[model samples]
Target chain A: MSAPKTTRAWILSNPPTDMPDESTFKLVEQDLSELKDGEVLVKTTYLSNDPAQRGWIQKGVIADRMYFPPVEINAPMSSFGIATVIESKAADFPKGTLVNCLTNWREYAVIDTTLGAPYVTRVDPIPGFKETHFLGALGLTGVTAYHGLENVNVTKDDTVVVSGAAGATGSMVVQIAKKIIGCKRVVGIAGTADKCKWVESLGADVCINYRDADFKEQLIKQTEGYVEVYFDNVGGEILDLMLARVKRFGRVSACGSISEYNNSSPPGFKNWFEVIANRITIKGLIVLDAGARWPEMIKEISEAAVSGKIQVGDANETIVPTAFEDVPKTWLKLFEGANTGKLITHIV
Target chain B: MSAPKTTRAWILSNPPTDMPDESTFKLVEQDLSELKDGEVLVKTTYLSNDPAQRGWIQKGVIADRMYFPPVEINAPMSSFGIATVIESKAADFPKGTLVNCLTNWREYAVIDTTLGAPYVTRVDPIPGFKETHFLGALGLTGVTAYHGLENVNVTKDDTVVVSGAAGATGSMVVQIAKKIIGCKRVVGIAGTADKCKWVESLGADVCINYRDADFKEQLIKQTEGYVEVYFDNVGGEILDLMLARVKRFGRVSACGSISEYNNSSPPGFKNWFEVIANRITIKGLIVLDAGARWPEMIKEISEAAVSGKIQVGDANETIVPTAFEDVPKTWLKLFEGANTGKLITHIV
Candidate 1:
């Protein structure tokens, strides 16, 4: 295939206020270059929209400052996506192989494999299983939940509480803690009533809507005993509440502080003293740093998915394959919490 | 020996403000109870006057929010001390042995061992060195430093930064990281010029006075590269500085927030966003919970002290063991930074 004249992509034109609107992102077409030696051309099949992406677009930079350089202005929004190899010059990955590419929200692109981007492997593309699991349950979010639980040494009989329970990472954490780790009880806190109920349906013992007037009390009552392991996705007040109710030697996995990510000012916690007095351990984890364990985590998650133990997306769930022009609008929907479960846009 | 009719003790009438004065702590004579079954009678020898004790008294609590019952109006002040066994009814502890005891600030006491009261142990004493080592290096502070370093996985390549380096635990941390862990660069942050100099003498690669006008700049210059392991003894601004300079996946052993412990309203860090971005791990540890490993830590510290690999107290240091009536007054000196290393009161 001759080099495509132009590829469609999305860019965050401006920071969003309140819930991010479609107007914040602009879709544009960019000229494509011929694939060079050691470079592989891949067509985007599934793009993962994460809560972290909200923070990424707002500042036009990734939060947690993990990435050395901030995302440049009017650039194709970069994220982790699954793509199919269309044309390949690289020896390791040949044409027709499906790969996980950490790339921009574009229809097609050439990737330099040297910059530590992992290729997809060992995936059987099981029938009746949603392909988006490669981005959600079987991908970065799943691996993150696994690593956090493992690193914090979550065990059976431990009471686990997770914030952002409806989100991909938080949902995976609840499932992994309860189903995989054999934790006795798992409590979830989510923003909306529907999200809370959905999390509970995913085998969570208890779920609380953080927006409720008596949410704190509900959380305390649901937890019963002090929380042993807190998988924190939302920070700010939710984190402070978890900190207040943390037991001695409690472990907090600070995955993503989605609550404060969009704020121009820093958020403060009132009960940070619990960190010292209660001997709580809080650690931050980025999935990119967990590259070495991806294969192992993928195997575990794939097995669970194959066994029908953990559900990714249901049959009735909508799989929208929007044009590259719709990428910006899709992200806006994500930020507004209009989409449920996993939201992906097919590039081809 | 006949049971003593009365014992000497110290009492706190009211919590002291700023630096503790002689009037804050009053010595009093108290009646002693005879040892019952499962009880051991202890004669106080060395009373540990720690900076933590000063902070604890000023805060009027041990852990935050848990008031120490206000020193019980006119009763003897409670403190942790080293004692000698005079008589015992317990099978584990025989008579006439040296032991570390957490008890009242008094000359003598009858304790019930079954109820977890003071008891004597036959462990090897502080190796013909200063008896005050029991209050400093061989005691709670030493064990704290050991466990903090161990739990955080401090290594040779790690640039370890410790705050409150002139204090008991901080001093031990600097020595432990240098001698045991063989950490190449260890930077210490202390409050005063003299304390910074003393920390330098304690084998720290660099020592910065936090009170200096160019404190943050000095810390940045001294560390050069991001810190890998930060043993935080003083939190607040010092902790904030370290948080900014910690390398990705760095480990922070939160031992004490001495800077906040004294403040009625402790200041919180404004830049906790660095925690999520850098993937930093912060763990709080209380040495008392390290029960299973205490014996091993004591052994390590003791051996190090014996071989002079780790210096405990200064060679020319003079210790004036204050009378039981002088316990509060002597402890007050800690807040004023009057003592050099370890300050102990002789109850006998």
Candidate 2:
């Protein structure tokens, strides 16, 4: 197949001070250059819009010492997604190969396989699963939940509480904690009643809508005021509340702080003393660090899916597909809580 | 020896919201009751005042699910101190036994050894050491520092930062981390220049006064912006600041939060997201939980002291002696940073 002459891409124009808007990115047409040795020209299939993107685009203090370096000004925004290699100089990733990698917000991207522009891994499409499943249940999202729970040594004796339970990573955490880990109870926290119901359907014993007037009271009642493990995705009032709600010797997996990503100045924790009083242990995690263990995570998740222990329904049900031009809008939807699970942009 | 018919004690009159004051406690004379089986009448010699008492006096949400139950209204304020058993019905604590136990702010206390009013352990007074040594270097304060540092596995490779570095536990931490653990570097944080100098005198490589306008910058410069382990004695802005200052995969031992102890609504951490970004691990500790390991800690500390590896100077230098009737005022001094080291009420 002949390489495409031009590619349309979205570049970060102005960094967002608070919530990102249309002005945060600029869509442009870029001319493609010939691929170098050990580089592959990949046709982007899907673009992932994750809450983590908000942190990556930040500048100054917020961007300092971050896990991933901030996206440079006027650089193509990056996402973890699916792509098809059409032309390649690299032996590992040849033509007609389906791979998952850190893809740019462009239709065609040249991936340096040898130098490793982030990373490139060839993924075998599961027979019954959609391609987007590799970005959700069987990918980094799944690995994050799996490794964090493992890090904390969550067991069947634990009553697990997961924040952002309706989102992709959180939904997987809910299922994995309940079905695979066999935790005594799995309680989820979501933003809306519908999201709560969806989280409950995904094997959470109960899901509390955090927007309720008596949300904390409800959490106290459901978990009996003693959560053994808390998988925190939202950092703000919820994180503080969980600190107070957890029992003595509680373990916290600090996954993501989606709630505070948009805020320039995030609020501090008021119930932090509970950490000392209860002898709690809070650990932060980054899924990218678990690259070596991805195969293991994928194997277990695939087996569970095959056995109907996890992903009982359509794995693609949670993926909200958006047009490529509307990628920035779809990314903004994450903060607005518009998309239920995973939000993906399908290139036309 | 016959027990006294009456005893003077300080009781919690009202819980303070921001800071404990003169009116927060009441001194009263109580009629002593006859000793029962397994009970010993103890004459309080020295009362150890701690920042933890501020948390113990809190009511409502702040006191909820605390490791130690809150001091009840009108109940005697408790502390760890030295006492001499004058009269006893307990075989374990015969008359004239010098012991260390949870003592009230009073001249005399009746201890039920078998029932274990908190706990009572016979502390053999070292021939060359002052009796107050048992309350500082050889007591819970030292144990807190030793165990917390050990809990985080602070090794020679670690560059440790300790908050409240001039206070009892903090001073011990500075000495132990540097002289015993032999860490690469030990940085201390205190409120004033004199306290910082005192902290540095205790084997800390450098001590920064947190009150300085460029305190954070000073900490960054001193530690090269990468602290491997943080022994957090003060929680609030400093805790949040250290979260950002620590290296990736850094370990934090949450020993105490003297900064937030008196605040009814303690401030939240603005830099809390650093936990997720850096993959930090924060573990809370309670010295009371390390009872079984006390012998191990005490032996190591004793050996270190004798070898001049820890407590090289006069062990009693940090003990700020006050009159028994002024116990509450002595405790208030802890928040004001009035006392240089350990504040103890010397009963006349």
Candidate 3:
């Protein structure tokens, strides 16, 4: 195949006020014909959307910051994706090889293998599953779901409770906690009835809609007793509510705060004293924290997926792939509850 | 010495709304006749006061509760103290032995050694340290401070910041972090200038008075970079501030909340999002969690104190031993900020 003369890329025009829109991003053409030594060219297949993108675009940077740099204005918007290697000078990557890395939302990526060694991963492509699962149910995203539960030390007897249960990572967690981990009960809190049902189908013992007027009461009644592990994806009042119901020595992992991501002054957590009283451990986990030794996690997830214990996106669905221009709107669909399982844009 | 026929005791009239005052507790005489099998009678020497007492008496018992039971109304208040074994029916404890246990606030205690095995400890007094050091620097109180820093995984490279650094456990934490752990820098957050000096004299590299108007600015300037471990004793705004300054993968130990013990409407924490942003870990620690293995901690603390590297209470001071009736007033001194270092009552 002839090497592409130009790569269509998206750059941040300005930081969004609350959430990103098309205006926040500008499309630009980049020349990628001349490749440097040890550089690999890859065509983007599936662009993964994550809540962490909001943190990347925020105006005020948190102290200490992240392992990867933020998506700077007038620069290629940073993202993670699976891609097909079209050209390579790197020994590990060859023509037509599929790989996963920080693939920008563009047609192709020019990855320098030296700096990208930590993130650039070769995809084995688990049989009987969509390639997007490499970015979803059986990949880095899957490792995040698995590691978050591991942080809390989930047990077979634990009544594991998770918020944002219908979303990508949360849904994966609910399934793994119930099926593979053999937890006593896996309860999920979602935003709507449809979302709750979708979560329940994934083997959750019960799913409570947080939108309900008596949400806290419903949660207590559903779980029967204190929660041993709370895998929280949505922070704010939901986190405080779970803290109230946490058992002694309970563990909580603050994986994401989709609920509070867009708000400046998120609600104050009132039940924090409960953490001290119960000797609970609350930890924050970034997916990137599952570093270097991902082969183990990838293997764990792939085995689960292949053994019929995990679910990925349907390959049989009638698909109208998201257009490059619609990427921002498709990303907004994540925060708006437009997708059920894994939300991704198929560029190929 | 002959066994006492009756012991003077202080009992709770009712659980306090916030801080315990004179009216909240009552003085009475306890009459004892005989000891049963496995029972050990002890003459109270020094009743050690802890901020956890307020938690024990709170109307809303924190979930998971405490290692010891709460002080009941019209009953002897629950507390830990140093006592001399006056009479013993248990083989483990002999007469004249200095034992540490939940002696309550009384002149004499009848301890059941079998059940007390988890808490009641026999201390081989160090040659030059005051007996009160068994409660102050070398007892369970000291274990709290030691283990709280241990939770945060303090390293030689860590810039350790501690809140409530002049209080009993807090002061011990400062000394242990600096002198024993050899952390890069030990910055203490205390309330008064005098307390700050006391903390500094104990080997803190820097001490900031959180009460000062420019406290936050001073903290930022002194810390220079992110704090790797925040050993928190006084939770509230100070805890929030330290959380904001935590490094990526930094840790925090929620040991005590003296500031919020008196307020039902304690100020809400605003910087909790920093926990996620920094991937920080916050864990609550109870000394009892180190059950059946305190000998190691006691040994570590004793060695530190015996080497003149740690301080207990003063042995060369004109000290007015607390009157039995003034016990309630004396305990209140902890919250009033009227006392420095170890706050205890001598029930002679």
Candidate 4:
């Protein structure tokens, strides 16, 4: 098949002065070059929209070192994506294979051995499963929640509290605590009543809206035994509240700090000594840290998804199929609290 | 010998509105009752002056619980101290036995089975060690340092940074990392140049004065390769600075926050995301958490002390023998950067 001469992609123009908006990224049709030998040609299917996208647009790291290089201005935004292998010269990556890779916010990509080992991983689309699951529930979002829960060394009687309850990872953590760990009390912290309802649906014993003025009182009343594990996806005051509620030797996973993403600096917290006096373990995690284990996790989450144990938010009901150009705008839905489960950009 | 009819003690009058001073506690001569069965009457030799004492004086906890109960008003100010068992009615404890217990800020205490287990553990004075070492270096100070280094899983070649390096726990952490773990580079953070010298004498490879104007630049430059472990005793901007200097997956022991002890709420930190991106583990520890292992730690630290491996500050030159009334003034020295090593009150 003749390769397409051009493709559509989104490129960052300049760092946002404040909150990110449509102007932050410029969508354009770019010229495509011929695929080289030992390379695979792939058509992007689904793009994962995450709060981490804000981190990428700005600086993903501090001055000392970087977890990974940030997206440079004028460069096409690259993130975790699922695609269909259309053509392949690499013996191992056969044509028709579904793959997950750092596909740019573009329609097509050509990856080779130089693209590095396991970066272009082959993914199997499970029968009777939504293909978007490969981008979220069976992908980074679920894998991250799986890890956040794993970090706690959860016990059947342990009480687990998860912040950012309605988000992708938070929702998965709430369910996994009940279905997998059999935790006694799984409390969730969210921003709205609707989000709380969604979190409760995911098996959380109690869901408190942090936006409420009585959040602290509500949190104390709901979690009487004190939290044994805190899955913190939202940092700032929400994390502080949970810190106060954590039992001695409790585990906290600093999965994401979405609340602090808009601000240049972290806000003050009063209960820091709680982290010390309680002997609480606070850990930061990156899903990519679980590296080569991705396939194993995929299998596990896939089975869970098939068993109807794991749930996800697909962009189908929210986005129109023909309006692919509006994909960049979909990212805003994450920060706006409009999207549920995994936010995805459906290309086909 | 007959027990005294009355004993002199310092009692908490009320919760301090601000920094702890002589006014927070009231000295009183209270009536002493006869010891009950299983009780041991002990004469206090030393009073531990710690930053944690501030937490013990306030509403120790937030709402639900506290790691330790607050010092009650109209009662003796109870904290860690070493004493000589002058009279005993318990089988495990004998008269003249040197022991460590939650002795009040007074000249004597009566402990029994009802007083709880392990709170009044017996200690044998090492042949060549000073008795004061039990309240400082070889006691909770050394054990806490040991646990902090252990949490990081320190390797021989690892570089470590200890904030408040001249203070009790901080000094021991620096020494233990160097002498026990054989860590390659041990960096210490102290307030004054004199304290830095003392930390260096304790085997720290380098000691930086946090009060110095160029301290931040010096820290960033000295830790150019990044620190594998950070034993934080003075949390605040110093913790923030070290957070940026920590290597990926590095361990941080929130041993204490002497700087924030006076504040009702902690200040904001700007580089907290560094902890997340780097996957660093920040743990708050209470030395008592070791529980059954305290005896083993005590034995090990005592061995190190006898071998002249763990050095201590016994106030041989600084503390005058006749000034018993000046005991509470010693605690103020910790915040004022006046004392070296462990600040202790010796009752003649």
Candidate lDDT scores, in order, read 0.73, 0.83, 0.79, 0.77
Q: What is the TM-score of chain A in candidate 2?
A: 0.94
Measured by lDDT, the strongest candidate is 2
Candidate 4 lDDT, tens digit per residue, B273-321? 7778889999888877777767687677777766878665453113423
- Docking category of candidate 1: acceptable
TM-score of chain B of each: 0.85, 0.94, 0.92, 0.92
Give candidates' CA RMSD values in order: 5.3, 2.4, 4.5, 3.4
Give one digit per residue, the lDDT tens place, for model 3 in A201-292: 88898899998999979987875558788999988889988887888888899898887777766665656667777888999987777766
Candidate 1 TM-score over all chains jointly: 0.79
Q: Pick the candidate with the highest TM-score.
A: 2
Better of 1 and 3 by TM-score: 3
**Judged by lDDT against the true structure, how good is candidate 1?**
0.73
- Give the Å shift of residue B133 in candidate 1: 2.6
How far does residue A196 in candidate 1 sit from its true spot (Å)? 1.1
DockQ of each: 0.31, 0.66, 0.39, 0.63
Point out where model 3 deviates above 4 Å. A1-46, A82-128, A151-158, A221-227, A315-326, A345-348, B1-46, B62-64, B72-76, B81-131, B151-157, B225-227, B265-274, B315-329, B346-348
TM-score of each: 0.79, 0.94, 0.83, 0.90
Worst 10 residues of 1 chain A by lDDT: A60-69
Please give me the DockQ of candidate 4 compared with the native complex: 0.63
lDDT of 3 by residue, B65-141 (tens): 55457666778888888888888998888888888888888878788878764368886767877777777777767
Q: Candidate 1 residues A34-127, lDDT tens each? A: 8788777888877877766665555534433544344466877777787777788878778877777765788888887655435443234867
Which tens-of-lDDT digit does each residue in A1-348 have in candidate 2?
Answer: 457988998999998767889899999998888888988899988877778778888755445578877888999997877999999999989898887887789888888777542267787777877777777788777888898788788999999999999887888899899999899999999999998988887899999999999997898898785889999999898998898888899999999998888786777676777898899999999887777677888789889998888873453334556677887877787888876777777776
